[model samples]
Target chain A: MTGDVIASRDNPRIKRLRRLAHEGGAYRREGQVWVEGDHLCAAALAQGHRPEAVIVTPAGMHWVERWRREGGLAADVPVWTVTDAVMGHISPLESPPSVACLLPLAEGTSVRPDVPTVVLDRLQDPGNVGSILRSAAAFGFAQVIALRATAALWSPKVLRAGMGAHFGLHLVEGADAAAVEALRVPLIATSSHQGAWLHTARLPWPCAWLFGHEGQGVDLRWMARATTTVRIIQPGGQESLNVAAAAAICLHASAVSAFGGL
Target chain B: MTGDVIASRDNPRIKRLRRLAHEGGAYRREGQVWVEGDHLCAAALAQGHRPEAVIVTPAGMHWVERWRREGGLAADVPVWTVTDAVMGHISPLESPPSVACLLPLAEGTSVRPDVPTVVLDRLQDPGNVGSILRSAAAFGFAQVIALRATAALWSPKVLRAGMGAHFGLHLVEGADAAAVEALRVPLIATSSHQGAWLHTARLPWPCAWLFGHEGQGVDLRWMARATTTVRIIQPGGQESLNVAAAAAICLHASAVSAFGGL
Candidate 1:
């Protein structure tokens, strides 16, 4: 059943949702993330995540009810109605969504050595981080480890950029390089300079790919741990590729190589 | 010689620079774009762009002088020093750069029919537009045609996302689908559904790539003109890849195939 309307911006729960939307690290402290829009909510449900609560604007009530009828939303979950102005206050986007939900952050999982994983080392851009997650998920890398300085994976910007990939990923944030080193799979570092060409190289499948900060390449500690380094050849002579672009090219190459012979 | 320091944010030139930084279409109105940071400035110079003027903070004077000595800046171009606060006021970035330049926009060029080209069809994200530009430049696609509904190619955000690839590109914005249809090379449309897998397809070298809006895939009008449609396979079952990521993979694949036998 739906709960009472929360029309006030001053409501304590609304304030917390607003915080979660604006601050990346707030999710860590509050133990929940605010996922906006029906696409993301459906994705979370598809991934078997139970929303702690759903907040919808008056105009969105019909859509939420439709979702409930379609089994996209749980019948038992409480839905709170908020005024359009209150929805705007809680949204971080320029165009506020009609609906949003508070979902608990998945419990942190240890790196699984045998499974393919992606290690993000101090990536600062939320878009790049989220894009990489989507690429990783698309290419069969089921796990992602974000090193200490990486953007908060649950941040609203990242969630929006991730485009629902977050629901399917086993994301480990604020991880140490040491934790990554403990994984048994071979680590592959991507370099813009001084490595065998990726297209020509014999890449390792089920390996851990280490992507770094925008300005900095993979850290020395991570580089030292790399079983091999690969470079994407730029025949047209641009200095380097964008980090997210680089990740997709590398991941797709790996995926193709892995599946090409089968 | 360096001109007088601008300590006041109200200075006419500084106000214009701030406008150029914050507004997407300001470059079109003012006939100039502000390029911030040394990397972008150097890239512009390397591409034979003549800066109308150079603006730097007090601490950045030495670097500008060195650039001048090295011939990165033209001797006749006026150099103005601004206080750090004034510099901040002229920058849209969270961290302001010490140096920036007011460079005249390249005269609008018509889409060259013979050159390898990338067409933007109502793509709105500044970063995606920029990233695709970088991929185009890196893959030897020297011309980019942005359809009328696409994001402003010369905008500050797109320029920054482009990472200096703008200097090397022949970009035509506010273009129509008919202009793209007139290109001599085969038009390749990227689709998330119902197309040959990109990796397995025989991609044409120096063809035109049509990238579409983030939410709406390539328009049917453009799709109808396509000689072929290619899809990037996603073994991991995601619906689609980010447009930028898709561009990189497709471009890089074309590059490799073109150069592989040579």
Candidate 2:
């Protein structure tokens, strides 16, 4: 389904793409998430996610072949050749990318219990949220639950930071405490002040790591449900680490401990 | 040395403060580094750094008393009270902070060999550089060397990402490959492919973990000089982890393996 070159900025399809690129919550309304660049598109395809459409510049048509070589970039998927200006109109990045794809957002997503998980509790920064997602995906945490107060999971900033981890993850956005409580795995809440040191703690496998807001630790009400509290040892006597860094260390610990080093 | 209320934005001292806050390279020219908020001020004080001047808003006077309670804030340090408008004029932050301090930048700093250290080789992102700095400090890597191609180490963005780790570090910025070669310890270069898995390696106690540019990775010349090349085992089958996350995982491995779980 090859679409003709779309040059007009006011095209209905272009307007929708603009909203998805700029607005953080637009994907929920549009039912499609826009992923820019080839790496992300390849990653999504690798996870068996077929894009609804692929948008590219005339010069960027080379990427179509590259994407096709990487995964099943289906022949039937709509390929919209657009002008360079139109590419910029639909891109949130400073230097507009050559290719991008619109993938249908999954509906009715639910948490998978008894699996490695990472939960974001009212975490603010998009960079922090996204970085944690990469760590989770890298360390075998297939499910990520973002509490209602957390940054929008599909936002452009977060998607970029996640770097294609989104496709491989079972992400439950806008989840509440009730939904989190439904998880069968033990909840391991991370604390900066008091908790079992991560290095020495006997970390449980298939557990959910609950990371909290930047300013405040885990909510007291949420903290009450935790099976154990863990803290990373700052041997340098510094106060604490950035949340993403802490998440990486903790998640890696579980991966190495439970499965042994690869 | 209590300076009286100065409300004018055009004041010579105010202009210098504005430059330091806004321009990333201004600290080098002015020979002073401006730090904002009580948290950073306390961190500097904890490291026995006496600010040349402490600028505060009229209502922000409470911070001066609070900072004085923290490690040796000093009696003779200049505490300059300014109008709220003047505070806004000098601040680089979105919401103007109540207190900021100007500390003299160190001169003629050199590398310390035979210590747990991190080497940033031409890393582009400020957030990545700063995050690495935090991980290095947290894991007891007391020395950090930023190659000439790396991001400006003392920039405001890097400073914010670093949290308060700058005070605890022996930072050597703007160094060439020659300077890095002078280091006595083993040079541990990190790679995404073709390296020993980090978990199984017998990591040295006081080696330099050389991290490279986010996109290009470690330079070939630098890699050639590496005593050992290490890579983190990504259990989830993801292509790779982010550079900062990789650094955190690698640094923590050295920390825990050598110290035996702190």
Candidate 3:
């Protein structure tokens, strides 16, 4: 633990943190990504991922010390004490959390097609992806497969939105319709206007759920291959549901159909 | 109609348009708001609101003129032609649409709580509020009332997330629990871990649906006042549902229970 403080905003490490927070490729280049706040950090440690460096201000250092005393952090991890300005320079949030860390990406797990899954087709919004991931974790969907154009499941916005769900699921991005087609499980596709009304259908348990883009529904190729199409019956006077909201309803319904009351 | 060319970025009209697009307070200060893309402009016009200014690129002007020739925009409305930079500057979207407009906020109608309604409590994210609004509109919830701390319904992020649902339903922001109490209808509050199973319960239709903060559920005072507490039965192994997702399920379930099959 370097007690030497980084007071200058121009410090090379601070510059790297700024780039990592704001841009996509910085993390890949550095072989690490920055995670903000205590909860995410705790979640990472819980998942057995070790932090490379913990950067904090003096007051934040005290908070980190408390975290260590409380058994929230690994005793052996290195902590870097930095000035408040340096901490702010590295934080993605408007108000910096007590700590931020450089952690390696969670390694990809081998994906099995037969497991109940949630497939994202070019779901471009990071927040939507994150919310869907949270729903997937909540409903016990075994995996999340994002089409090539979908937002990165581990991107900063998605990570923030997912809360800690990213640490709990099998997330595979840059996938295609072929991947979904290969799954042996029944595939359920959602639409604003189509297929079976979700509530009335004999929804099968442990089935794959397919959600699509904000403006566009499931991709045409996947739609063609989908065994059945389901629509959440909207009795209201409006048009369609947000894809993420729809995913939550569909996932919850599937979970209940599979396992009973929540 | 003056055919004055506005090529310079420093033009007052252009600067004002940029400000209106970027600043949250711009609309309130100027008594005007910007609507970009054909869909939103069409939605506004359909609601009988006229725009103060219409800025379009040369190509956009040509396309709009063709549409007008084919009986698109109302004939009496004035449309201003502009350069691409001006059009881009006034647009909130990353890829600016061909047309952009500064329109007055439409006068809101009185809240009619006779039908299904959705109430938001201290929802701070503009995107979530917008998505919830879209869900409320789709599920036949007649009105959406946002707590004073809820993101402003008319904020740019919300306006975009909501698509055109803002025009389709009655939206009132800065509301309180008293407003929910005043509905004179049964308030169905959504809970993650308590209450009767949503499906089996004799849920009320056309009822008032209540959702709380992103991190917290409904305020305890509001929860205690709720006529019924209901939860979506999830069988899988997750802690809680995202607030927006929870709202969609509850609202849809209410619609189903009251109206019969979705």
DockQ of each: 0.69, 0.65, 0.67
Would you give me the overall lDDT of model 1? 0.87
Give every prediction's interface RMSD.
1.3, 1.4, 1.6
User: Measured by TM-score, how close is model 3 to the native structure?
Assistant: 0.90
Residue-by-residue lDDT tens digits, candidate 3, A1-262: 8579888878787888788777754665676778887777777666666788887777777757776787767788888888877777777678887777788765554457788898898998888988898889888887898888888777778888888887777777677656776688888898667788888878876688888888877888888777888888777654778899899888878877777743
- Give the whole-model CA lDDT for all candidates, comma-separated: 0.87, 0.86, 0.77
Candidate closer to the true structure by DockQ (higher is better), 1 or 2: 1
Model 2 lDDT tens row, A68-163: 775568777889989999999999789998899999999999878767889888999888898999999988888999998899999888999899
Candidate 3 off by > 4 Å: A8-15, A62-72, B2-5, B8-15, B62-73, B234-238, B260-262
Error of 2 at A6 (Å): 2.4
Which lDDT tens digits does candidate 3 get at residues B70-119?
55466666677777777777776789888766787655535665766788
Candidate number achieving the greatest lDDT relative to the actual structure: 1
Residue pairs with colliding backbones in model 3 are A236-B139, A236-B140, A262-B233, A262-B234
Ranking by TM-score: 1, 2, 3
Candidate 1, superposed: residue stretches over 4 Å from native: A1-3
Instruction: List, residue by residue over A1-262, the lDDT tens digit for candidate 1.
Output: 4657778999998999999999988999999999999888888888888999999998888878887888878888888899889999999888899988999887766767678889999999999998998898898888899999899999999999999998888888889856786788888998777788888888888888999999987889889889999988787785578899999999998888787552
> For every candidate structure, what is the RMSD over all alpha carbons to the true structure, in angstroms?
1.6, 2.1, 2.8
Q: What is the TM-score of model 2 when looking only at chain B?
A: 0.96
- How close is candidate 1 at the interface, in terms of C-alpha RMSD after superposing the true interface residues? 1.3
Evaluate candidate 1 by giving its C-alpha RMSD to the native, one decimal. 1.6
